[model samples]
Target: MISLQSGELFDTTIKDLLIPADKVAHVQLGNNLEHALLVLTKTGYTAVPVLDPHFTLHGLISSTHILDSILGLERIEFERLETMKVEEVMNTNIPRLNLNDQVMTGLNLVIDHPFVCVENDEAVFEGIFTRRAVLKQLDRRIKNK
Candidate 1:
């Protein structure tokens, strides 16, 4: 639980709100767009992290990225999904946070992203801090006050 004071909310670290990587649904960089789409669909997430075999964070893959990559001049080219890799279309310019970062830092980043990936000093995937978790904390604090 978090302290009710507004100032205390700012003191909260992302570590407390993290959704560990093991529990998060993700796809590998080498996986084909077909596989990526399946994972995204099965998980019901718009986007998911792309990781290497070593579990290092690489980028993010989204259904929109997959769809756009397979779009042809005249119609949807579904065949490309089997040939193209997730690495080819993943969005690399992603917002990241460290476990020690404050909730306010996450609050700022999640304004644009639904979730922000968390990485260690080595850039290894640690987990994610989500907008939903931050909002829940804020809602709790407000109700307590």
Candidate 2:
């Protein structure tokens, strides 16, 4: 049987819970909108962060954004997605966290957002703390008790 020591759960940090970016599904930076949409369709994630060559976070793209773009047009431009850049439609306003931040801090942000982008002190992207991951921990603790 597995055992979690006392205070172990409470002491957890975002870093301890985050699933590294590479491990999670993602879309590459500068990829075409069609490719990004394909990624989202295949991965089934509502959104994915766009990362540069050095893995610095550029922006996030979501199905809603893509749909909105199509909706804004008088007529659906299916081919436009093929030529559009992800950077052009991606949302630049995103929340972020440092691994050193307490889990509660990360949790609060994630409660309002789908995930919290993790970064180093220098603002280099690292990974993400997803809401599903936090809920999984809660589920485990509840079951253990």
Among the numbered candidates, top lDDT falls to 1
Per-residue lDDT of 122 in model 1: 87
**TM-scores vs. true structure, each candidate:** 0.95, 0.88
lDDT of candidates 1 onward, in order: 0.93, 0.81
Worst 10 residues of 2 by lDDT: 1-10
Query: Which candidate number would show the highest TM-score if scored against the true structure?
Result: 1
| Tens digit per residue, CA lDDT, model 1, 33-140 | 999999999999999999999989999999999999999999999999999999999999999998889988999999999999998878899999999998898798
Instruction: Give the residue spans of candidate 1 off by over 4 A.
Output: none
What is the overall TM-score of model 1 with all chains considered together? Answer: 0.95
Residue-level lDDT of model 2, residues 1-145, one tens digit each, is 2124665654677788888877766676678888989999999989988888888887789988887766644778788788888888899899988878877788789879989789878777789988888788778877988
Q: What is the C-alpha RMSD of each candidate to the true structure, in Å?
A: 1.1, 2.4
